[model samples]
Structures are given as C-alpha cells and as structure tokens.
Target: MKRPKTKSLVVYGTIAAILLMFWISWAGGIVPQVWQVNALLQDDPMLQEYPYKFRAVLLASGVATMTRPYDMEVAPFDFLQVIEPDLAGKAPNDPAMVAALKRLRAHERRAARVAVSHTAADGVEWVLDRAWYHKHGIKLPPKTLVY
Candidate 1:
C-alpha cells in the first residue's frame, strides 16, 4: 500500500476548512441569538420616509375617528407591506420593474401610500421610490403588518 502525500493532505484540509466557514455563516443567519439588530437595519439606509411609517402613525395616532386609547403600542415596522428593490449592477427599472409593481399591489388595502428613498455610498448611488397607493389603484388600510 502507498502512503498519502503531505501536500495532498494539506490541500484537502484547507478546502474543508473553507467550506466549513461558509456553512457556518449561512446556517447561523437570521436567528436573533446569532444575528445583530443593527446589522439588519443598517443593511438598507435610505432617506425617504417609508410608507409603513405613515401607516403606523395613522394606526397609533388615535385613528382619526376613534376616542384616544392608552394601550396602543406601535410596532417597530410601520407598514404591513414593504417593497425593497436592489438595483445594484444593472440599469434602473430593468425587467424587475414588474415584480416591483406586484409588490406595490400586494397589500393594496393597507395603504395607498408609497415611499421612495435613495442613498449613495462607496461611489454607488441608489434610488428607491414608491408610487402613491391610491394612484396605483391601491388603498391604505388602517393596521400595518408586522413580521
């Protein structure tokens, strides 16, 4: 029987280590215990006011026609629906425009309000905007979605 070479052993060990690191990162993602809150929000830092922001305000601000209540605690996310677009390397409003439109229509009754935001960083410019809900044939509902 022939013995395995030292170089071959070293190469195989290095590859195994690399793959393990990747698996650790992927599998541990999303669990709060293994994830950071700031890490998630900071991932998208745009300036435009979010539609959910408006929706939450309406829901918690004493609902225009209801008597003031003391138990309303607004959730962290303002809207039940959020449409985030990633226009990273391709042209703006590419084939993904249709998907964007569909996202807009998903929770139509929630809020006819759409918010757009854009941020520029590291020599890259980003633009995000949502059309008016009513204009899109969608209406804003009272309670926002939280998940």
Candidate 2:
C-alpha cells in the first residue's frame, strides 16, 4: 500500500496539536474549580452536616462538577435564589447551609487569586474566569454569596 503523503501527515499533525491545546485550556480552567469544590464539599463542616442536601443543591444548580463552560463564578450557594422556595421551609437560614456558603465563597476566591497570580496566567483556564473579567474591563473579583 502507498504511504500517506507528507502534506496530509502535516495537516493531520497540526489539527491534533490545535485540539490538544484546546483540551488543555478547557481542562485547566475547569479542573481547579472542581478540585476546590470537591475539597470544600468533603471537608467543610457545614457542607458535611447535610451532605445530601448540599449535593442536591450543587446538582440542581448545575455547579456540582463545576466543569461547565464559563462556570468559573458559579457556586452551590448562587442557586439559593432559584431554590429558595424548595428550601424555604427547611434551610432558609440553616446553620450548615449558611456557613457552607460563606466558606465556599472564601475558598473559591483564594483559589482564583492563587491561580492567576501573574498576568501570563490568563492564558489558561481561570477560576472565577478572572481573565475574562479583566478582558471586559471588570477589575473586581467575582461576587460572593450573600447570607
């Protein structure tokens, strides 16, 4: 059989390289958030108080994995508004939920600050999408969960 032409091989190689870069950028952006969220879910006393409830909130909020595109600023607590009715009778001010929200917000912020310590850090996936915010003339960090 005849071997593939050099031109064809180069084209295929270039495509693969581009795909790899995109994959890296996407994963880099999401992995850190996932790591931070999971870590909080596992270790935060408030979150652990009602693991199932918190997990349900995370899933329902579409922030469970924290991997969705442009999901850097999403947190489990952000969905509190949408889910207030469902939880109004139960955990509106549940100590665990409130504490968890505060802790998670702080944790996310610190992670973002660390991940984007330098200007060049913007090239990768940023927690809180800090790079995107900066590009849009928003100099402040992401908003936090309100009690």
Candidate 3:
C-alpha cells in the first residue's frame, strides 16, 4: 500500500491538536455556560417572594463570577432596582417600559428600606417577571413576607 503524503499527515496532526485542546479544556472544567444561570434564576425558590430583586442579584453575581466563570455554577441576581434603561441605544428601553421600571425600582427601594429598618433589617430581595406580575398581580415584595 502507498504511504500517506506529508500534507495529509500535517492536516491530521492539526485536526488532532484541535480536538485535544477541546478535550483538555472540557476535562479541566474550563467551559462556562448559561445553563446554570438559567436554572438558578428559574429555581431560586426564595425568588418568588421578591420580584425585580432577581435582576439586582444576577447583576451582583455577574460581578462576583469574573474570576472563575467555569467554577461558577450559580450566583444571585442584582441591580434590577437600580437599572437605568438606555433609551437611545440599540437596546433602548421602550419609553413606557423605562418609566415603569423606574417606578418599580422606586417602589422596591421604599418598601425594602422601610421593612429593613423596622422589621428584618436584612432587606430581602425578590424577582417577578412581567408576565407573572400581570397574571398574579403582586401587591408587595419578598421582604414584606418577613415583615
């Protein structure tokens, strides 16, 4: 049988090298994904109490996970209440949504501060999606349960 050419050998070597690198990274737990975040965001049971607080907790988690994205399985949400929508950019918040978010943030801050100072003092957080809010119509936040 004729031997393979050097060109074929080189191509095989390159493919093998790429595959080896991918395998090494996977074995070393170097790949980070959005699955865990989605799970935590979806399954954080305490989350049912405070809506929008989820956004803040997630923001905080993002900041915290800068070092070990792969090792980071799940983290809390943050910055929901403080979020300022950029209305003029590509992701511009609709005018009505921006106004609504600001109002919601204000409400969260007011309620949280009051509950923290007078009752728990820890200030619990909560997150509620727009769909859920409209469906169930929550009158209060997560902290209110503790109060």
Leading candidate by lDDT: 2
TM-score top scorer: 2
Candidate 1 lDDT for residue 67: 13
lDDT of 1: 0.32
TM-score against truth, every candidate: 0.20, 0.29, 0.26
Across residues 10-30, which tens digit of lDDT does each residue of candidate 1 receive? 889999989998997886433
How high a TM-score does candidate 2 get?
0.29
**Ranking of candidates on lDDT, top first:** 2, 3, 1
Question: Model 1, which residues run further than 4 Å from truth?
Answer: 1-54, 59-85, 89-92, 110-147
Q: How accurate locally, in lDDT, is each candidate?
A: 0.32, 0.44, 0.39
Candidate 3 lDDT tens digits, 1-147: 335687788899999999999998786543232233334434554433544433222223223121110112211111222233332232225565556455555554544443333221243444444333334343333333434
Minimal lDDT window, size 10, model 1: 62-71
lDDT of 2 by residue, 38-141 (tens): 55445555534432222111221223322211354544443433334344334637785686566545654443343333322332232343343354454454
